[model samples]
Target: MVTLQLRQLTVPPGHRVILHNINWQEFEAILTELGDHRATRLAYSQGTLEMRMPLPKHEVAKVIIGDLVKILLEELEIDSESFGSTTFKREDMNFGVEPDDSFYIQNHAQMIGKERIDLKVDPPPDLVIEVDVTSKTQLDAYEALQVPELWRYEAGKLQINVFQDDKYVESDISPNFPNLPIIEAIPTFVEQSRTIGRSAALRAFRNWVRDTKNI
Candidate 1:
């Protein structure tokens, strides 16, 4: 993790000071005050005071994951009404963090009162996906959110972590949807720049499903 440096500069008696050191806590407080502003997507972290922003790679990966989830919902006949990116916040331990993608299923979708949500609510999303483009480890974030399941796509593979007994356990495959071929083909998706639009990938997945049923 990189630490931001704040410097103080002295000026002549008659001149105005060019720079001054600002306390990290005070900086975070200013960000909190601007929470109502719609233009602000992310604020500084309370602990590190690090300014966070969504990257382009994050957006691309999110689109692919969202599309896959939509396809899965249709194939599995699951009732899902909403899907969104890292625009909502989850409050835990006096800090709020957002995941890359989140979705509500079944009756949980009925609780949404508007097109956007900013506050924490009961029963988080059924699934949360994160595109780990940053070097910072996500273990702490996962622990804080207390979400039931999380999927991370990083270094050409998909890692599924299921929350159990206040901790996350990793597995080679997703337990939430056992039949999905997300894990098997994630490497190919990561390798090809235009992989998401490849018809062969979907055809391969369909073949895998058929083979599983015949066995």
Candidate 2:
């Protein structure tokens, strides 16, 4: 027989505690316990446990938004780091959730550590991307982290939300990259990706840029 020990995690107000210190067997057991609940999902770290609930479908629009951001990053001259399906944890609530894609700009992008990020002090990603495939759990995760900027992509459109004045507000432009034409370029990228290979897409983008510049 295998046994698992549970430890309470101290989190700040408005955050929930995550249980820590369990083996794989224990982790599986917990999920089994919560089977078919549809209200919560459990995430396990090396020695930690994080519990989160589902969010509404509209809340996961960041996935498509992230794909758009990645393509833009490759085209622009800026130095940045982008991640797909990466996990971030907030110490205040012991909450751990994975973003569809997350990014950091310029020097801030280099600050990421090699192993695990210590979310207690490190600033959250400049942007969080989520795709509403099925559940609302993504929204619950973001709310717990109190991250600043989140872009959700759903129903074939993108919505940009920024955390300002202690709340989230929709914006016409992204706070992270004000120069990029997000709305104008996103749909084009999405449409192109569906019909052509990646190299072809790049060539088309180059042509579009040259034509727009009258070069």
Candidate 3:
């Protein structure tokens, strides 16, 4: 039998590798080995584990969307704590995922001084953002964790999914920000970032959010 160490494997950019039948202990060991400094993204469900290396465009989009969300919260005077791609997992449920970005809006106070997320005791993020520049998103982990809301950006569009009755259903409105047209407006700003520069696009988005208050 041929054996390969996790370190021996290299997932190229814009690609993903899947390991099937990975037991819980093995998953923990692999995560420990990978450490917190890596660039690869991960999602584990049941006995399957997936590792993906995001494209450069994917990196830009997720960060801009995260910035937009924070802008929205600030403009509205809504307190929030953003955790960019912090790994979230539950051993009892056998599910784990690292989102593109996450935020604790309603539960920000509870997470004020927390060093790390322990899903068994801590609440799942109020909102999770995923930018699918390459692979399709695996929703099982988010559902298993009962994340209240999700925003998925794909093919230059944003789709909001709300957790309902133990499952995810597409929703036009984000419970966190129901007043704005997130679906139509977010993609525009994200696209603008490519042409006008990130800072300019973010500034435009911030201005737009502030303008919404006047109406």
Candidate 4:
């Protein structure tokens, strides 16, 4: 058997490693060992642990989508607390996931001034955004954690999944932004940010929202 520390293992971007038969104790220890400052993301469920590093393009999309989401909330005068990539885990459920971006909308009041989260006591984030989630394990982790709404950006398209009946059902429109055309605007602006510049795209998005609000 080979002995390696978490620090010794290197997971390249756009790739992941899966380990099975890991228990809850080991998962917590691994999280402690890995520490909070790192580029890797982890998803653990039912003794299976998967860790991966996100690519540059993946990061770009994450930031753009997250920014647009903030803009939407601001334009609509909705109060929200943004917890970017916070690690949410629970030993009881044996589920832990670190999303690219997380926001507290419906439950913003409870999360105010809370730097950390305890899923057993604290409510799961209202909206979570991730990039290129091709694995069922990640989705399973989110469902187990009982997050109300999840946003996934992949292949230049946005997928909104709502939790119901203990499962995730894909929906065309986000429950958080029901009246707005977020399904189209989110992706359009994210892509626009890359070409026209992030600042320009953001301004355009804000203007679009204000225009829509008046109509």
| lDDT comparison, 2 vs 3, better candidate | 3
Off by over 4 Å in 4: 133-137
Poorest lDDT segment (10 consecutive residues) of candidate 1:
10-19
What C-alpha lDDT values do all the predictions have?
Answer: 0.56, 0.58, 0.93, 0.89
Candidate 1 C-alpha lDDT tens digits along 113-147: 65655445555566777776643435555566666
Model 2 reaches what TM-score against the true structure?
0.62
lDDT-best of 1 and 2: 2
Model 2 segments more than 4 A misplaced: 1-67, 106-113, 206-215
Query: Tens digit of lDDT per residue, candidate 4, span 93-132?
Result: 8889998899999999999999879999999999999888
- Ranked by lDDT, the better of candidates 1 and 4 is 4
Clashing pairs in 4: none
Candidate 1, RMSD to the unseen true structure: 8.5
Best by lDDT: 3
lDDT of 3 by residue, 182-204 (tens): 98889999999999999999999
lDDT score, residue 213, model 2? Answer: 36
Arrange candidates by TM-score, descending.
Answer: 3, 4, 1, 2
lDDT of 2 by residue, 1-215 (tens): 75443323333322344666656566556555655333444455555666654344323234434545665665555567665555676544645666667776643655655444667766667777765444333454565666777877665666788877666778888776576656566657655755785456656765554454342
Q: Give the 10-residue window scoring lowest on summed lDDT in candidate 2.
A: 6-15
Give the Cα-based TM-score of candidate 1 against the true structure. Answer: 0.65
Per-model TM-score, in order, reads 0.65, 0.62, 0.98, 0.96
